[model samples]
Target: MAHQTRIPKLASILAVSALGLSLSPSWAARSFTPQAGTWVISDEVDGKPGRGFAIDVQGNTFFMQVFGYEKNGDATFYAATGQMEGDTVTAPLLRYQGGRSFGSEPRDAQEDKSIGDVKLSFRNGLQGTMQLPGEPAKDIERFIFTAPDAAYYQTEQWKTSSRMARWFGLNAQGQVEKSWFAMLKTSPTEPMRLTLSDGQTSETLECSLTTPSDSIRCVAANAADAGQAPVVKEAQFRLLGAQVAGAVSLQAEGAAPLQLLGINTRADYPYSGGVIVGCCANGLESFMPGTFGYAQRPAYQPSNGTWVMDDELTGKPGRGVSLDVQGGKMVMQVFAYRADGQPTFAMGVGDFAPDPELRDVSSARFSLQQYRGGRSVGGAASSGELVRDEGEVMVQVSGRTGGYGMPAGSLAEAMVQFPGESAKRMRRLPLQPWQTLEDQLFGEWYFPGLSYAGRPLTVTLNRREGEFVTNDDGSVRCQFNTQMLRGECQWPTATGTSGSSGPIELQDAFALSNSYVRLRDRYGNLVGLGQVPLN
Candidate 1:
């Protein structure tokens, strides 16, 4: 467990007093919202696998369902729902029985009785504690399966990394519009470029990197009319995680400068240069992509793909869920084990709806069903019949939009109930690499428009070395560690003698779907895009 520092009460009071503020009752209280997802007992995670709590919070209402085992190792579940005060909630734990099971007819589970009361106290969004009846308080935390990239290509080598930015401002007709910005940036030394589009026309601008005063000066990158004044003068903003909020100064032709408040979503660390800097030219405010009023704005959608429970990827027999969304309909299949340890599955199909209070969250509820009498794979033909109303399942998908209006930062949590059992919480698994460094890069590659002599170039690479042969009988060799993704390549002069050598960098070599690797020089200029043929 990670250690956390606790501030002394007297010290906290002294610190607040030093800020020259009165210690009011409201000011002394702390508030927190528990992030909705799967949580586990921190210390007992390894010893007690297959047991966890699914917790969800909307406003001050808290809901939790625990799945575990009885003394004889029989499966058991419990549920609790209550309103939270500050950062804590206590509620009665209830059990149920007589729910429908696989191959069983439709039946509703009935509440058996209250077992005991449970207390939950949250320290923050990700960490908390839980106290069950007859058990000591246990430390609990959100199970995080996904971790961000630990390294990135330098700006000098990549030129520009593209990301989607959410922009909010009034269009040319003086009506507010929520749109997207194609934000492009190199390193701190290069100017930040932005292009705002409403799915029709677009406006572009170039702005300096964030200044000391937390502002960026902008100028027209492309002007419709020559010798015209720049469309944007300046912008001042703040960056919090992936969110950007601030105000911009827009200059209309023959009009006074207009100050418009705006907010944008930015890429994660190192790419954003730790500040908000973007702009747009032309009359973008007048063009709204969809409707005029914010009420008619389109909701963000989650991308359709395979999702897994992050912490449970042990290549062992465990629970998993498959989600398929088509238009407004969603179908989920959960594969797990029965109380007697037999493998079983439940399916749910329903419609997706956006959360009224959370812009980034969408949900669906389905009547759970199970099937039986199915044929085995590659066996005799057989049909399966559904056992309706086996239970209920609810899924919540949370995500954000990025470049090309695609889903980014997508996360999902599900509350699943079986007849006679309590709901269980499950979360989408994080991305995992399926290929090795050698599998991705060891081969012959072709680069077109790579030679100064106008001849196509072909390079052969092994685990440790790469050779580039020129059309003029000149050859250069590079030595690199594929695991590091960096190397040095020697340059041959006109006389066919080794002249100079510089560093070589490649990006996204192990990307699962990539057919090529981006090659760049030490100064970040594009050397060639190396493509490998399909086997």
Candidate 2:
């Protein structure tokens, strides 16, 4: 017979304050928010396949849910929610039963008993330690199935951007049809590349932007290798805000030259320029980079802000959801009315996993927990306690468009299920109007060194009385007009370098966010502020 270990149940909650845990002095100088995602005991992710922990952090509030097995091999889950002190959080884990499950009638989950107090201390966003009752502390880290591709791009010093554009037109049978195009640009000087695919075959095009006309002209980049006449002889595309309008001329060996007008089916963010590109894909599909080698899929982080259902924008505004995604983890809060028309909200935190059915879609499932009996508005130090399990909510995001075009990861589709209710579809509601180029450009920023071995840079800008000025004592100063996405900046020249004394002309200025910006200097070299901490 094997000796089995069992989790002890407690009638009373442990007082964590009596533990007298000390806080780190370094954490006082900088704010460190633990990345929200699946966390597991270090080196035990594969060894313990059926057990792990999911942590969701909203501001300073940390919620953790642990899924494991009982001594008899029955599955069970424990949850704890508490405020974080510096980089540490301690709370009493609670077990609940008799809650609503799939296809069951609605019933509140009652607290069964207190398991024990659990303490979580983070060394950084990706690494941490977890201390469970009656067990030794274990090392932990964020569970990453695949590393983000953006990290690879940064390591290789390759500046890249990408976007998705839809093309709609009448087909050969005179029926309306639509297709998608993935646009990628390596650098300012590199030719713009366009990829078109139909789930099976793909085509590539090398394009250039024609000045004055402001039209993108493209030629087949892979036609000759296929031993076939180029399907696209010439293409002229003009980006109209989020919508793209263009005409493509096709050539075939046995067919006459044909011209087709193309228009997009949906609206998106305004176009900035080629520098707005990111790593080669936009979640829809991946493209071969040819010379760029294998580029991993970038981890998708939906824009941080409030999101409402698209259909509910004009009505009385009954209910809405708030979404905040950080470091690949997502925390969603759904606010709605209860049975008696009383307002209530439920929140969940989890990681977005790749969807099995849709190649371009990623979905996250959350065990929604409702908290009650906490501090009131303007009340003294008190915390909320989870009172019941509300239900489950899942959000599926696709076609993330951002980084100079819109807010990065701005658009997505979602579904919510509460207890016995069926799932409902929801789309991200666009609340704010599209920001002007000036609005995007005006902000304080911090960027890592542009050179391989240079110090980080901090930049502050303000526009006063029709003029832009840098508030910092930095060597770089730039000015630009809203009408054109071009500017001129005075930058320091390397010692013993030969160049004109005149200011360097810059173009393709794109503000991906208040903290991230990209530009191209006259020499076609890349210069921009990336997401580095200003502090």
| RMSD per model, one decimal | 25.4, 19.5
> Clashing residue pairs, candidate 2?
160-277, 160-278, 161-277, 161-278, 162-277, 162-278
Model 2 per-residue lDDT tens digits across residues 318-414 = 3445554532345555544345433345556665544445443456776766555432212232234445666667776543443321222333445
The global Cα lDDT (0 to 1) of model 2 is 0.42
Q: After the best TM-score superposition of candidate 1, give how far the Cα of residue 311 lies from its true spot, in angstroms.
A: 31
Per-residue CA lDDT of model 1 for 178-212, tens digit only, reads 33344545454566776655333455678654523
Report lDDT (CA) for all predictions.
0.41, 0.42
Among these predicted structures, which one has the highest lDDT? 2
Best by TM-score: 2
